[model samples]
Target: MSETTSFGDWLRPALPLLLLRLLIDEPGHGYGLVEKLRAAGISARGTTVYPHLSKLQDAGYITSHWQTPETGPA
Candidate 1:
C-alpha cells in the first residue's frame, strides 16, 4: 500500500485508545470529541468518530445523554 493508506491503517486502531484517554478526563459530545482529537493533531470527522463512540457505548466503555444548550432550540 501507499504511504497515505498505511498511515490511515495505523491511525484507525489508535483512535479508540486516544478517545478513551480524552474521555477519562471528562465527558463530551461527539462533535466536541472530534474537535478535541483534531486539536490533538488527529484528523477525525464525525463519520469516523461516531462509530467508535457507538462501539464504546455498546461495549460499556462510555455512556451518553442528550442535553439542550442554554441558547439553542430544544
Candidate 2:
C-alpha cells in the first residue's frame, strides 16, 4: 500500500467492517480471508488481519470453528 504500515491508512477504520461484509457474503478460514484481501489489493497481512478477526470474535461480531481441509493438516 501507500503507507509503510501492515495495512493501508485508508483502510484502517473500515477494515473490520469490510471483513464482516466479506464473511457475510462468503465465510472462510483465516488464510482464505488473507487471500481474499490480497486478491482485492487491500494490503492486509496476517499479522494485521488475525488480530482484527480475534477482536471481532471477542466482541461477538463474528465466530469460527475448526474445519480440516481434505488435502491439508487441520
Candidate 3:
C-alpha cells in the first residue's frame, strides 16, 4: 500500500454532495466536472469522481448520455 493518501480519500465523504451541487445548475461530463471542482480549489481524478457518479446514477440522482459532436467522425 502507498504511504501517502490521495486527495480523493480526504474528500470522498463529501464528494458526492459537492458533485451534485455542481450539476444542479447544468449537466456536465466527467472531465468538465473535474475541472469545475479544480476551479473551486478541490483536486480530484477520474478514479475518484467516476465511481461516485456511478453511485449517483445507480441511486437515480443523476443520468448521463453520450453526445457526439456534429463535426466529429462517428
Top-scoring candidate (lDDT)? 3
Estimate the lDDT of model 1.
Answer: 0.87
What candidate 2 gets wrong by more than 4 Å, as runs, is 1-7
Which of the two candidates, 1 or 3, achieves a greater TM-score against the reference? 1
lDDT of 2: 0.85
CA RMSD of all predictions: 2.5, 4.3, 4.4
Compose the digit string of candidate 2's lDDT tens values, residues 1-74: 47375446668788898799889987777778889988998878888889999999999999988887899688
Best by TM-score: 1
lDDT (tens digit, per residue) of candidate 1 on 6-41: 657877898888889989999888889999988978
lDDT of 1 at 33: 92
26: Cα error in model 3, Å: 0.5
Off by over 4 Å in 1: 1-5
Q: Cα miss at 43, model 1 (Å)?
A: 0.6
The per-model lDDT (C-alpha) reads: 0.87, 0.85, 0.91
What's model 1's TM-score?
Answer: 0.84
Candidate 3 collision pairs: none
Instruction: Measure candidate 2: CA RMSD.
Output: 4.3
Per-prediction TM-score, please?
Answer: 0.84, 0.80, 0.81
Range of the 10 consecutive residues with the lowest summed lDDT in candidate 2: 1-10
